[model samples]
Target: MGELIVIRHAQASFGSDDYDRLSDLGHQQAELVGAALRDMGWVPDRLITGTLARQKQTLRGMGFDKAPEEHAGWNEYDFHDLLRVKFGGTIPDPVQHDRKTHFRTLRDVLREWQGGGVEGARETWTQFSARIASARQAATREGAERVLVISSGGAIGQLTASALGAAPEQMIALNLQVKNTAISRFIFTPRAFFLHEFNATPHFAPKERAHLLSYS
Candidate 1:
């Protein structure tokens, strides 16, 4: 059986001008997860990452020096742009700066976007979903027994939801709950793909390290 391990990129600069890069704590979290995987004797035959700085940086921090294939299909949807489009070209101050308010508003906006309510967005829900499917196909191709993929929460959430034959709203819920550097595992064959785990943070599960767990 082939195993596909998808990792959500570590915490990003949530309220910064450039949210595509990982924060200092994000790097630490990536390193810790890398160590945990290595200790578990889990090594991937192939490495893949979305064409985003945070995704790529997470892979690097994980101590994998191998050249990874870059796939745009795994890239995250633009939530900022979606928010702007949804609210007449401006993101509310509370949503922009407050984590609680941001996610609360994002949840509602994502549902609206999925239902074809949000206009002037770069990618529609169907298109975003399609690309994630394509990316999954590419990652699970024959030849690699173990594949590691680094992606953002939205793409990973959508992928996991689709694998479980779940509704779109479940993706949003999963997205909000995924912690930084969390691992989601899938077992696959030529004809079937099954989700083995979702949003697991074994690296930070210890009481001493629990404070490192973060969702952003």
Candidate 2:
């Protein structure tokens, strides 16, 4: 049997010029996750991440001196571009909108994409989902008993949801709730993979570090 840990990248620099980078708190969160892994006596035999800067930075912040294997498949879907194309290239400035509105719009956009309503997408929903599946198939190949993957919420959520044969809405819901630096675990054997846990924040305890817990 093999085990896989899928970790969402910590809080990114949302509303910043470069949203791909991790925030300061995100670095702290990444370090805490590394500390928690040490506490649990868990040492991953393999590491993987998307090409995104936030994912790479998080891996480095977790005490790794070497870079993990990078896969573009694990990269997040372009939600900003999705919004633009869906809205006929006239996207409303997100800064003017509240969190609720943003999320609500995201949810609707995701649904539209899933329903084949999104035109001009870089990749269709089927292609995006297939990319994630391919990443998993590659990661779970033989010789790896424990694998750690640092990815964005969308990729992690989609993979885990598919593992459980979840409905489309359930997958969307999972994506929405993925907290930064949260760990989602899976049990994998030669034939199958089962979700063991989702959205776990074992690192943020003791009240003071509670502020480190973030979903964005």
Candidate 3:
């Protein structure tokens, strides 16, 4: 049996030209998560991250000094590109930097992408799922007792939804609620994989850090 901990990257610069970079608060969130892991005395046998700046930076900010192995399969779907493909020059600019509008747009984008609206996207839903499954298989084959992965909310949400046998809509809802730097734990045996927890934020439990609990 082995334990797999998946962490969604910290806050990204929403409404910015470059969303791949983490915001200042995102750094704090990553540090808090790292502190929590340290307090738990967890030392992962292996660390992995998606090929994204925010994902790598989040791991680094968490005080993980050693370079983590990059997995392209862990990369998130390109939301901006998807939007363009879906709307064909009709995609609206983020309205007023409003969180509600931003998320609504994201949901629409995902819905379109899932429905095959995106052109030249790296992977379809089937392909994406298979790729992630392969990644998991490879990680388990490494024979580590504990493994840490840093990725994006969409990938984590899809994985969780698949594990729970949820519908596509359910996955979208789950994706929306996943907090930045939140940890989801899974227990895996040779025969089965069990989700022990999802979207847990023990590090920022106090009221003040409540704002740190954001998915996007």
State every prediction's TM-score relative to the real structure.
Answer: 0.98, 0.96, 0.91
- Give residue 19's error in model 2 in angstroms: 0.7
Clashes of each: 0, 0, 0
Q: Which portions of model 1 show Cα errors greater than 4 Å?
A: none
Tens-digit lDDT string for candidate 2 (17-71): 5889988899899999988987999889899999999999988889855447888
Clashing pairs in 2: none
Quantify all predictions' global Cα lDDT against the true fold: 0.94, 0.88, 0.82
lDDT of 3 by residue, 111-174 (tens): 7666766666656766776777777776666468988999888788887887787887677888
TM-score of 2: 0.96
Error of 2 at 11 (Å): 0.7
lDDT of 1 by residue, 145-208 (tens): 9999999899989999999999999999999888899999999999999899999999998899
Order by lDDT, highest first:
1, 2, 3
Q: After aligning candidate 1 to the native by TM-score, how far in Å is the CA of 3 from where it should be?
A: 0.2
Total backbone clashes of candidate 2, pairs 3 or more residues apart or in separate chains: 0
